[model samples]
Target: MTVLKKLPIVSAVFRKVWLQIAVLLVILIGNILLDLMPAQKEDIHGYTLYKRWAAFLGIFAVTWILVRVVSVLRASSVMGSRLAPNISALLFTSLRILIFVLGSLIALDSIGISITPLLASLGVGSIAVGLALQDTLSNLFSGFYLYVDRPIAAGDWVRLENGMEGQVGRIGWRSTHLLSSENTVIIPNSKLSNSSVLNFNLPFPTASFNLVFSVSYQADLDRVEDTVRAAAESALRDKSDLSAGTAPIIRFTKFNETSVELTLILKARSFPDQSELRHEVIKRIRKAFRQEENLGLDPQRIFRLVSNQSDLV
Candidate 1:
């Protein structure tokens, strides 16, 4: 019974292997036939037109097979899965184009065409084009760097030094797409390369959140601290989004004229959980302050009377 169940799986595997072998054999046989075929007429360079055509076809077949092999390698996990699908496809397409262009030049040379002058002209023309599209090339190169270095990947919450914070949607040749709030922001890759980016999703998803509050200056500092700490503990008790492993920290930051400034630091599971966690913590603290008589947090105001300028003169 087990053999019957595994029979289809084995057959499918065998069929896939056979198909790949058959494709390779076909490409090999085609190239062999092209080499053996006789030339019809000779060109000015002593090479035949038929041979040139055959060479072009052979080059194309070889490039196709190489591309297929690369795809197979990617599928087999030979090339690590760090690259996104779109980036991988783009790289492979670029490789195919480069191979085709080089092959075409060779085929043309095999005919009556001189490649020396063509190569020289292409070099000069490429320099002129490069100067004209300097910014574009910069972005393209920066995009390539981003992909290779992988400081930030798709779906990561990132904040740029310029204060553009969002979730990365896609990384393209020219720009990166970011989803910020309700809008989609397109930032040039060059800008991204130059700017400092903070990736919150990397290393770990846990993020530290700091909340500052002030209590009445008349309240006892130790009592205030203990009450706030108890409130924070109660807030984080049942919340799964708050990291329970790290204990909440409380510190008296400053002494104001009417209030004492206190800072509370805690950990949230991720960036998205920060807002809700903060809200819950604040609500709990506010309730605790109202219920406890010694934990008053109302600000006090003192007024001073000033004489008019004419009276001073």
Candidate 2:
């Protein structure tokens, strides 16, 4: 189906699973034939070398098959899980190396080569290396857990327990990158795994905010609510993507010095949409109130824009 498969040599190798089985059977039979064939004293050394070569080839075949299986699993399982491509690749490579290493050791043992000393040294070295790279190993394992658990993902806004808040950018083997306030923040995976995180884009990304505005005491409460509701409803109808599929909530609060306070609770599909949604709703409502001068919006009072980051509901 691909250009690589269209090649003469490549196509032959991938022709059929039975073809690979046939090659494996040939390798096994060749080893058995080596033992069955009659040999003189002068040819014994050559036969020993041939047997070692055959053993190596057997190991190579097994490793090759295992690596291909790993590749298939990586493509289907890892990629399908929506894991970071580089992390999946790293895991695939690690599995391949483990297979090849075990295969090579088995091949050596088969040829009467002792691997005990090598394994012993490797064990001691691994302990030392593990101790030295303690933090790195912790981050690596934490990263693996983070990827599998999927608590955070790219483009999701997350607030960490330690006052760190941002949108997730990229997750790596060592660190989770965050984009905050136009800056890239690199936090270690270990910290993210252990910390309490609030994801704004999960458990339903729809977020609500309250708009507190006051009108002159002379304004009719019933007329004010009706006018503002119509305006906000118009905004929601026009920008469906920003709407949270909920109706606007209009309620009155307390009395002020010369005006009564009213609150307009509105919902946005996501946190980022709050700005545009609020903008559209406020623009429509203000215009509606202006057209209906009887609504008494208190021209002396001005609307001051406040940051919506803390307007989480």
Candidate 3:
């Protein structure tokens, strides 16, 4: 009773299920010790044998209970429920399996059971499983590396090698799920691990985009520049979703066959918004240029057609 009073509660619970096993082990040990006792007392076929076996069983039960007490504390410290409830079952099951395997091996050895054959069989099975899941293992390891390195995460807008632009929806162990404007794409972790990935939503959320606006050569260069600048400023000011930072840049880049090429650079929240902003700014600039008569026809229409002497014939 005093021993029970000092015993751990966790160990007491486990002993309920393992008490019989502990009894069997104790009996085996006591029988061997009895054979070494004095010749008269060593009579293994009497009530003395039962008494000795009972004492052994008691010791075995107490020891097993102590071990379970330690296991409970260890398991509590590493409980998956503290991290995530959904994964708690997996964590607990794995821990219990480990405890069972180790405890069984130790208990078996105490009872004189050989473990070499069991270990050899386990090793062979492990090798076979490794060979069968080589590719899956690679992807699993790669996924762990990716999570640790964190090159990309969920909600990041990325551009894949295949020219597909999408937001990373999830980082799965075997595949990365992406949600694009057109559809959802599943990219294998193997491919993502080896290929290039462009994550646009990291370091900063906004980026610069370019818009090319070609004007007729006959148009007034000065007025076109001012008009384009106003259009760009208006576009940025009108959007409540876009963040304000640098001013829009309007520059004359080159002279083409029939028009003057002007480039407008502006910052956008993301790739999708960039295209919309560019189109809005261009539309405004074209409207403003058309309203003002000073901005004349494009060079493509203003060119004079000349014929050679062969046309006179």
lDDT of each: 0.71, 0.79, 0.65
Best by lDDT: 2
Model 2 spans with C-alpha error above 4 angstroms: 1-23, 31-56, 72-82, 213-219, 252-262, 290-292, 295-310
lDDT of 1 by residue, 1-313 (tens): 5673566544433444555556556656765765565765242343455455555555555555555555455454435376666667777667767776776777677666789998999899989999999999999889999998989888888899988888999999889999999899999999999999988877776777787776665667787788779988888886865653577998877877776677788887777676777788877777776677443453232111111111100
Q: After TM-score superposition, what is the CA distance of residue 191 in candidate 1 from its true location, in Å?
A: 1.7
Extract clashing residue pairs from model 2. none
Please name the candidate that would achieve the greatest TM-score relative to the true structure: 2
Score candidate 3 by TM-score against the native.
Answer: 0.62
Candidate 3 off by > 4 Å = 1-112, 215-220, 243-245, 254-260, 294-313
TM-score, one value per model: 0.69, 0.75, 0.62
- The residue-level lDDT of candidate 3 at 108 comes to 55
Write one digit per residue (lDDT tens) for candidate 3, span 1-313.
5675575554455555466666667677876786677777634467464664455455555555555554464455344234333234434455566656766665555555688898899889989999999888778767766776888888888887778778888877777888988899998888888878877766776767766666677767786677778877877788737623568877888988887777767877765566676667666766665565454544334322121111000
By TM-score rank, best first, the candidates go 2, 1, 3
Model 3 score (lDDT): 0.65
Worst 10 residues of 1 by lDDT: 304-313
Residue 83 CA displacement from its true place in model 2, Å: 3.6
User: For model 3, which pairs clash?
Assistant: 216-298, 217-299
